[model samples]
Target: MMTISSSTFLMAVVACLLSPAVQALGVLPHTATRTPSSSSSSLFMVGRASADADFAKAPLTQDDQAVDPNVYNVNDLELAAQLWQVSLSSKTNQPNRPANTPFLDTKPFLPKDPTTKYVVDNVVVQVSRTGGLGMQLWELAGGRDDGCGITLIEGVSGNAEAAGVLPGDSLARIQYTTSMQGTQSSTTATEMDVAQAITTLNCECRDFDATMEVLTSLPPPEVVDTLTLTLKRLRTWPQIDVVVE
Candidate 1:
């Protein structure tokens, strides 16, 4: 009879337990090894057996390629990573769409003819201390009394009458030139009060003459040489013929 040492018997038993045929017989493997200093042959056998089982269970493709259960191909992994990065970037960098808005019309409406037409002309007048313009002015009834229009009370002979300004004439605009501090400036007034018009004309005449005095070294008389006024007169009149039988 051959005598087997206890350690050798133990190593053989471990090898049998780690074998797949022994595992099919329902036996659990031991943790111990043979020589107490050798590599774990039982553990290596168990690992190899488990790897073989996994490879057997993995499904094969139509091309007969042995698909790995745990390993990933480097090219496939890189392509998947690139696709994921592209999808994320497209979502993050998308532009906002403009909202639907309605359009608006902004053209202005204009009239063909004006309600009133003005006769523009320049008139020269001499100013007096007692009565400036030497004309009478009246506020018209049913007129634009917001200082935009005025009626002349004429027929009295003075500087205004000499300037051909007639009675019932309507004045709508006035313009004049004035000088102050050696600077000449033009002023225009579309709306003015009777008192304000008198003051403006007087000031303009005084300032202009004073400026001329400084430039020519000779004093000019206090008179407005040119005053622009917009006058409105009736364009049509009613006529009646008289018949004597």
Candidate 2:
């Protein structure tokens, strides 16, 4: 069984956001992979717009252009919803939250160079007579490593997620072409013949000034997409609350 300790994997989820599709999907972990319903799409746009507004002032490079202000079509919104997988884990194991627990606070152990700000809303903290309420949506993944037969955390419903995804559903591959992975590709030049031809780009230079262009199939004309989301702190269990019955 795959156990999800929220604190341990939150960084991995954040790391997954580096993918261009994840940014387009407007969530951290799961990249968007479908067309969204119209209402869901509108809500996604609201959240996406909010995210863009928040990031607008950051010193980012041209690669960040994927998030520029734009209304997403159905596929974009669907992918956004799929990518927002945090809430599913939340529903399975919300702790016995104190009646007076502060909604937000800073963690000393987390990276402090540029403090990550967290905001929690519309979260349903689960209450158990024995276990109390645990923070919801710890993590999500498929049972198989090959990305098939995926299972959601138990006793969770992805539909209740503000991001508009269903729980326990297996995610298919992102409907994208991998045409950019060859030797002739300007980006990620995976050359088989020449060793010196492929030099990894500098980290700082790759961060602020990189703009890669790729040609891929668009979502079907009938599909419309958008993204809707909310967020919360990356949580860890206090020593006093770690025991499970």
Candidate 3:
């Protein structure tokens, strides 16, 4: 729930966000397209979910038609967020850059109850070359570390930019998970039981769905609040080699 009204560190995070590659959402370049015949053979395709489809639906399938290339996938959009690196530093303390905050290292940074979903009200992602990307989370906007998807801001450089990721994008989810280490025990109330219960307590460290949106360039700011963080593997943007039509 930290506000970055005038903090230099806050400004640094904002500096890393992506620039406006497109003046408006509609002005981006024509997305690479594929015809029905070409769709099957095409290496990749970008499209929108059907009205009947759920917002939390899995990545688009072949059935979903190409809505537009200018429109990015959730995965691609989240890459922008990945470019940002968010950490905590007291206002009293100042550094050239904001320190990484291990907010979720212990305790339930996020609630364990399934009903209590994490939702961010307002999220701003900044990308940069000099520093890195910054994810500005606002509590007033309903953002928190325990929410679904990657709570920490991300940055993009080198490989990400070369792959066609643009600035001003926001990631929705990632596609990987690792077992948060827990204690081991045995007996009626053994250490293992305590460790297992604590370890299994589902605190979303990152989200794959949100990351997917960023990668694909289709993140909806309207729905940013309902997203959850998952421990998903990073999706590698499809490598493009010239193709002979």
Give the range where candidate 1 is weakest over 10 consecutive residues by summed lDDT.
Answer: 10-19
Q: Where does model 3 exceed 4 Å of error?
A: 1-68, 71-155, 176-245
lDDT: which is higher, 2 or 3? 3
The C-alpha RMSD in Å for every predicted model, in order, reads 55.8, 23.6, 21.6
Arrange candidates by lDDT, descending: 3, 1, 2
Error of 1 at 149 (Å): 6.1
Please provide, for model 3 over 125-241, each residue's C-alpha lDDT reduced to its tens digit, 9 standing for 90 to 100: 232322221222211112344444333323334323322333323333322212233555555454453211111123223343333234335233332211222221222222234
What residue runs in model 1 are displaced by over 4 Å at the alpha carbon? 1-131, 142-150, 180-226, 237-245
lDDT string for model 1 (1-245, tens) is: 33221111111111010011211212111112211111111111222234558666554334333222111111121121121110012233323212331111111111443332212122222222222343333332222322222233322234444444434333333334443343233453443322222312111111222212222321122432334443322111112245555
- RMSD in Å for model 1: 55.8
Task: Tell me how many clashing residue pairs each candidate has.
Answer: 0, 26, 73
TM-score of 1: 0.25
